[model samples]
Target: MASIGPNEIFFLLQGLKWTVALTLIGFIGGGVFGLLVALARTADHKLARRITAGYIAVFQGTPLLMQLFVVYYGVALIGLDIDAWLAVAIAFTLHASAFLGEIWRGGIQAVPKGQTEAAKALGLHYPSIMKDVILPQAFKIALPATIGFLVQLIKGTSLAAIVGFVELSRAGQIVSNQTFRPLTVFALVGLIYFLICWPLSLWGARQEARLQTASR
Candidate 1:
């Protein structure tokens, strides 16, 4: 068996790079879609609200691992070829959209009713009210939760390994198999994940605290 060495370490770092890249793709794509989901959830139209609610429920209620499986394998079964990276990206984006949408919906609803009323009094349309007055404030309210969800999304990228994406967890598996040192390989992997996630967790907590203090 090969000993853990610079080569293995470099491989792990490369995997980390992919992990970060995947996280960003999921976040940016999800953010765009999630904004629409949030808007639909809060729309005046009951049908829009119900449809978005069902979308959120389906994604949120399902296991992310299963979702990844369906996206990665199920698509191919339908005669559509897709790369593992694309499949994983699609899965993560869908999962993140559902979660982030729900989080932002809460933020939107938490905005003071009087503010919406005041916007209406000023002859503002629904779009203008939300765009100018409601969304900005809702974003602030949702910032902490959003960051917390981002941290989750970062860790969740590990699941991409199941679909043959060589993320951090998969890299560790490879190194462990070659080095015959599962403990050492996984310990390092866990540490790397901690280092990446702990700061974001702390930042989220700090943001929550600040919001609480401001509200007082």
Candidate 2:
């Protein structure tokens, strides 16, 4: 036991704040970017769709850890300050955008063709058709998956610690380094993650159930 105390627990708990904050930053930033990607992918322009597809493929194809490393060290190589928070935020946003864009694209396509035809008959343009006719119904289908993605995003924040972000997992590492108790520290950290994610999983399931009922 290497001097574990209330202060140490407090330190770890404080790091939890960073973890939650970083998760939100990634979620919101990625969510907006993802919506754009999804829209672009579904656009009429073949070249635009292809370019967006390539962007998604590259990000989704690579490991997120490598992306994190690139963000951390790549910016440093260019003589930018590139703080841990900004680096982690940008990396996770790009990562989340790829996955979320795909999720949302699936939802948009899942909408019935009849719906688009009906909207077109109502004199709606593509943007208005998507906004007024498609997105509303599609969002119902999207809710469960989006919530599930949020859980993944939260868990993914643990990776931020790898780049010295001092979030939850890093807090555990610091504690483990001092106490030499990786199992206990990491186990507690895992439990904390579970506490955050399990409820989200349940909520997503419930959302899916309700949507199914409504659609039927």
Candidate 3:
């Protein structure tokens, strides 16, 4: 069997770009959709809140793997032509949106009731108050949580490998199969993931600390 060398490592690093691309696609798409969902849930109307909650429930309640599989097969069953990357991106966005929606909703709710009362006392409309006062504050609290969610988002992109989206995990598997060194190849992949994720985790923790300090 041929041993891994610099060329193989370089090949693996090329796969990292796809992983990062998927992570970016997932985060941006999920964040925008999630913000809308969070905003709906935070709206004054009961119907809006209930609808958003149901969306979250369905996405969060089901397994993400199943969601991916359903999209893959379901699209084909419907005679729709979809590529693996597109399928994975859609699945990731759907899954991430639910969790991020819930996280932002909690942040919105956590803003003190007194803040709302004060906004009303100032002759502000609900939208004006939310836009000018409450949401700004809520976003401050949401920052750390959002950052924390980003770490998970990066890691979650690995699931794309399931549907033949040759990301980091899929790249590792390819290398191992070619080299016949599963343990070594996978261990290196794990190390690469750790290198990527550890800094984000630390940064998120620091952001959480700063927000808490500012809160106090």
**Global lDDT of model 3:** 0.87
Query: Relative to the unseen true structure, what is the C-alpha lDDT of residue 21 in candidate 1, on a scale of 0 to 100?
Result: 98
lDDT by residue (tens digit), candidate 2, 1-216: 776689878988988999999888888999899999988888889998998899899888998888999999999989998788899999999998888888888889999999999989988999899988888877778989999989988887887877888999899999999999888888888999999899999999999999989879
- Poorly placed runs, candidate 3 (over 4 Å): none
Which should have the higher lDDT, number 1 or number 2? 1
lDDT of each: 0.95, 0.89, 0.87
TM-score of each model, paired residue for residue = 0.97, 0.93, 0.92
User: What residue runs in model 2 are displaced by over 4 Å at the alpha carbon?
Assistant: none
**Per-residue lDDT of 1-216 in model 3, one digit per residue for the tens?**
779999779878978889989888888899889888998998889999999999999988897778889988799999999999999988888888888888888888999999999889989997898788877888788888888888887877777788888998889899998999999999999999999989888988898999878879
Worst 10 residues of 3 by lDDT: 151-160
Among all windows of ten consecutive residues in candidate 1, which has the lowest summed lDDT? Answer: 1-10
Clashes of each: 0, 0, 0
The top-ranked prediction according to TM-score is 1
Between 1 and 3, whose lDDT is larger? 1
Error of 1 at 5 (Å): 1.5
C-alpha RMSD by candidate, in order: 1.0, 1.6, 1.7
Error of 2 at 129 (Å): 1.7
